[model samples]
Target: MDEVSPFAEVLGQAIYQFTLIKPLLPTYGHLLVSALFPIYIGAHASLSKPSSAAKSPKKSQEDGYESDTEEDESLGDTHKMESLAPSDALMFPLTAGLTLGGLYLVIKYMGADLLNKILGYYFSQMGMLFAIAFLKDCFAVIRSFFFPRKYSGSGRIWKPKPAERVFQGARDDGSSSESLEVRHSPLPGILGAIPLPHTVRAALWTCREVAYWRARLRIHVHRLLHAECWLSVLDLLSVAVALPAIGYFTFVTKPWWLTNFLGFSFCYGTLQFMSPSTFITGSLILGSLFVYDIYFVYFTPLMVTVAKTLDVPIKLLFPRPAGPGEAPDTISLAMLGLGDIIIPGMMVGLALRFDLYLYYKRKGMHKAQAQGNGSDIVKPVYQSAMGGWGERFWTRSVTPSEPELEPPYHDARSFPKPYFTASIVGYVLGMLATLVVMQIFDHPQPALLYLVPGVLLSLWGTALVRKEVHEMWEFSDAEEEDEDSSVTDAETKEPVEAGKQVSLFSRIFSAPKEGSERPPKSDEANDESVDGKSDKKESPEKLELFTISLYHPRKRETSKLKAPTERGQSPEDDENWALVGTAERDAEPPAKRLRRSPRQH
Candidate 1:
């Protein structure tokens, strides 16, 4: 044969490499994508506040700013944010162990065929709902990235109207309101100056009316489809595409790509809705599952059997090369459970939140120090960009006049994520280790055996190096304030001094008694006078007499006394008379006042 041309040689080499790489590409690609789930989920969770903790609409309106909770409400999201407690961590593994044991017993006696059929039907239905939600979220995320919602009348054009101008003029001149007959310009700008022909003007006017009406129609459609229904045009189209795609996967075909797609959606949904409240809780959860995974995989056949038998989106499947003597058309597959990803992923996500908490806490401290009051530090609130239902599908671009709101420490995407970075790095390494061991031994491995250690050690090691062990250990995303205690605090006491250290015992037992002196107000409160001198003080004896007179009881006959106003009298009105009569009673001794009757008055 003649020497091959340079082009032919290059083409042959390229084809050889691609063919060699093709089998391994999907395996590694899926692994890489799965690794990233935690960071994304964690970052998103940190950025979002609990719906219950979100500001009330009245408070938001009073502050002259709308809150993200309003948008969450409009979206019809009822799933409250839940954090895994230590108790949950302890109970979870026991539950999983019991579930695995049950499944193993059923499979041993009943056979895998019957179990798969029942599970397949159930998962298919659940998968459809999850896929739709996943697609909707994707649309929202993409739209938000490209065109974020505007605030403060931003991105809106001002077209000065004659009516508004006249009203403005009247206000400026301090004159009574008057109607001014306004003349309309047939054509505006260059067209007006050009003095176009009547036919041309009429054509332009007709076109303008048609364009206006078209815009009006579009607005109505948007309101009906998106604003009221909370379903966008894109969302409707995606649902149309998704239903067919899902049906094809369920009935017509069960390809690896479709399976992976549905599996990824399920994993994402799990991460989105659930998380560990703290690093410790995450550790407990991961550690428990780590042993759980190893024991089930090595000591028993439950995990492997269930994973193989379950024909659903509970696990990601990657195609492997056919073994020797196998037909080229025959496909072999490798599998990774959703639990492997979601479990370590939860810990990694918690690490990301820990990073966020540290960042915000440090920022607040620095600001307080800069203001010369270290005790005045307040955690900066995270503001979410999600807004009205209309903006979910479409948003206006930010105008020069209206700049986008800058988050305190920049957005979640760009924030420093050392803990998240470490955990994810550990996760990737663990996954690679699992693959390597599997290839060498020719046996499947329990992924969490490597993953849990990798993730926990990486996070704990970083915390140790950074000297943030205590902070990391104690940090939690759950609301710390007790609602009942807050109400009690409000009713029974003045605002506590910011920097003053008070013991729990003191807080419980130091409440002011009936005759005891009140705690002194803060210096700021005391310094409110114009000349900075304290207000005049009443004598202790006079204060005591006034206090005693206010507590004197009156008979029900007092209800007969009516106010001069025709408005219905209240119990408060009778109390007001009691207060007025207290001045007269102050002249008498305490015993004499008590002996007096309401009928004498």
Candidate 2:
């Protein structure tokens, strides 16, 4: 909670007030689920909840996920309400009082504006990226729905008519669940080519065969991402596990503290065939988040407060230009004092080591077993690199040390994001890739022309990585078994209830019914005004804020009492103020001033 990413801190404000995943927290929870936070980590963490199905990864005891289940059950039963003893509520006031007081000191006394601004810029960019991603997906969905023939690979370009109708989403026996055409791509002649854009055609050719380049990108990207995520997880786990369960020491850096783990993800991604730009770009982003988390816990409140005291914008330290008449938004350098450094430093150190422990634990567990985890289990490297199950199993059993193919498949996708997205986010991202390549090669920047690659990449990803583009299915039968499992349903389900109570309105209304009218008391209703003539009316005090100034000095000034200036100007004195000019008046009793006022009139 303390070491949250700044991106999250920025996005958290809006997200918390709206979403209800971890319902108790406000926007802080939202920041907990931002782009900087590799979605898989949190999503996978949530997966540890008690599953009815067996094969899902078991929850670690230290994580409190298991305890959460019992607590939820205990909390849900209305009969237990009476059992809430005095002790439970006793500390509540202390926690609340301290929390509010701390927040006030941080916001009012310290300074929150500076922190808000830096984070705001980062999160705004995050929001834009998300918007682009959403638009891409929307376009894809539309193309699929409207121009199914063109979008589906079996269109005029690739279509090879089958003797029988395909009735897709139906039984293999050709029974119709929904009527659909069945056709295969007409294998174009070796010399033949399609009329798509050159880049698109090249990408299509590269990826369409399902052989070399297509799978390489996927494997490499996954390896890079997974390794990096593991690094982050280890860094965090060091602190998390130690503090809560095992006694944590004040010091907690890994023995060889050079951060080599980040490279694991990138290297893995590269081996899998993900774009180098992607590996680097994703690393840059997550790296920022990691640093931000460390920084916020240590410096943010102090920096802002110190900046205010100094009457300097916190940003001035970074030496950026300031606009005229604008107050500098500053975070205080003073905040990074000794205590700030020590406490958070310890926490971060512990987090890193904890992740290392976890990796070893998993490895140790695998060692304890004899037959080894099945061939189907994904290795840390992407599967596309090596030969499929049979070749791998036989090789391992016979001459285990001998390497088979040049790009031996590693079971893991280093940064295993959902396939469809990895395939396509490439299009818009390809532009970024080109920039990186140019920068790396010290070449001229491609302007409009470089956009060609993005378009090409997009089409390639779209055709090959679309929903149901399960190219690996043929190679790994384990996936088919997983699809049939209840675990899959739980993973994909929109319903938040994990075999627990679900809101009636959410269950009934949000379900994909043709027309479901459940209740008006939804989130939208919550946003409505609070009843009666107006959903809300400004509190009487809110309409106008009044200020009263009392004089308790040795000099008595009865007539000096006067109403505050209307529009910040007193009717008694007619004066114009200028830039760098002061507003001043002689001290006098109101009676005395009243008598003297005739001269002014």
Which candidate's lDDT is highest?
A: 1
Write down the worst ten-residue block by lDDT for model 1.
214-223
Candidate 1 lDDT tens digits, 165-267: 2101122122432352321223332223465666775665454332222100011111122111233444665588678878887777678778887887777
Candidate 2, number of clashes: 51
Among residues 3 or more apart in sequence or in different chains, the pairs in candidate 1 whose N, CA or C atoms overlap within 3 Å are: none
TM-scores for every candidate against the unseen true structure = 0.58, 0.18
**Local error of candidate 1 at residue 568 (angstroms):** 23
The residue-by-residue lDDT of candidate 2 on 417-488, one tens digit each, is: 333333224323533454344434543332223333433344334436544234222111011124466685
Best of the candidates, TM-score: 1
Q: In every candidate, how many clashes are there?
A: 0, 51
lDDT of each: 0.57, 0.27
What's the CA RMSD of model 1 in angstroms? 18.5
Task: Score residue 151 of candidate 2 by CA lDDT.
Answer: 17
